[model samples]
Target: MSITVSLLLWVICLSCHAWLQPGRYGLPPPRPGYRPALWGTRLLAPVLALLVTTRHDAIAGILVWCMTASLAGLVVACGLCFGPRIIGTDGRRVARERRP
Candidate 1:
């Protein structure tokens, strides 16, 4: 259960981290108000995950947190790389849109 929670939190954290920098991903810029929410989630989720895990077990919690963070990072990276293709989006189209 703790592992699940940690994984979810890490995924959310990484996703928000990615969203906070659209140019890096070749995505459209976010709205001004949306940035605050992304920043909050990106900053808060990892700490919450850490607290939840450590509350369960100190030594083991840290280990599990590290494992979950690594797996979650891979998950987010795959999602960013392949998600658009899965949804029929073209890389070139996104690149075109990114230009002024």
Candidate 2:
């Protein structure tokens, strides 16, 4: 079960990372720093999920929890970094169409 959950989490994280790659949504190319943070998030997600599921050792479990929290934080950061542009553009289109 732990393995399956870890695999699922890894797949989701990888998909999200791939979707954020250059030209995925026709967005401008990402800055170099962006790649490392995004890749690190993708790499850590599976390890965290595994730790959460296989919490046999106390110290290991705590470390996994910390990693999971970091993963969540990175996800939030990614959203903040990219979400506004998508939302802002969509909102502008809707407003323009509604105008007289």
Candidate 3:
């Protein structure tokens, strides 16, 4: 697959991961009896499989899989850690960028 396509897939995966934890960032809360995090965790397997299949050779396939995994994790972590501050309600930043 083209690098551009791969990047697009990674972005989608990341956004899905972020949506998994919507409440923390003030996006939206999860529904009752439904664990949003669990849904995303389950989805990672299929997404990784799709990403891996994009490459024909074993080496490239492995590399792509690893890359996708790392990027996905980073997205989830960043969303949990910095999402709210990045975009607060009412068009204002929830927290300042400077350290205090």
lDDT, residue 53, model 2: 60
Report the C-alpha lDDT of model 2 over 26-100, residue by residue, as the tens digit: 234457777777777788876677665667866655555555546655664565455534323232322113336
> How many Å off is the CA of 24 in candidate 3?
2.1
Candidate 2 Cα misplacement greater than 4 A, ranges: 1-16, 25-28, 56-100
Best by lDDT: 1
Which model, 1 or 3, shows the larger TM-score? 1
Q: Model 3, 1-100: lDDT tens per residue?
A: 5444554556666665555655445455456555655476457754665555465776776676667657766766675666545545454445557768
Q: What is candidate 3's local distance difference test score?
A: 0.58
- TM-score per prediction, in order, is 0.82, 0.38, 0.45
Candidate 1 lDDT, 1-100, residue by residue in tens = 9999999999999999887777676566679999999999998999999998999679999998999999999999999886652121332334323335
Stretches of candidate 3 off by over 4 Å are 30-54, 72-100
**Model 1 alpha-carbon miss at residue 87, Å:** 14
Positional deviation of 86 in candidate 2, in angstroms? 5.0
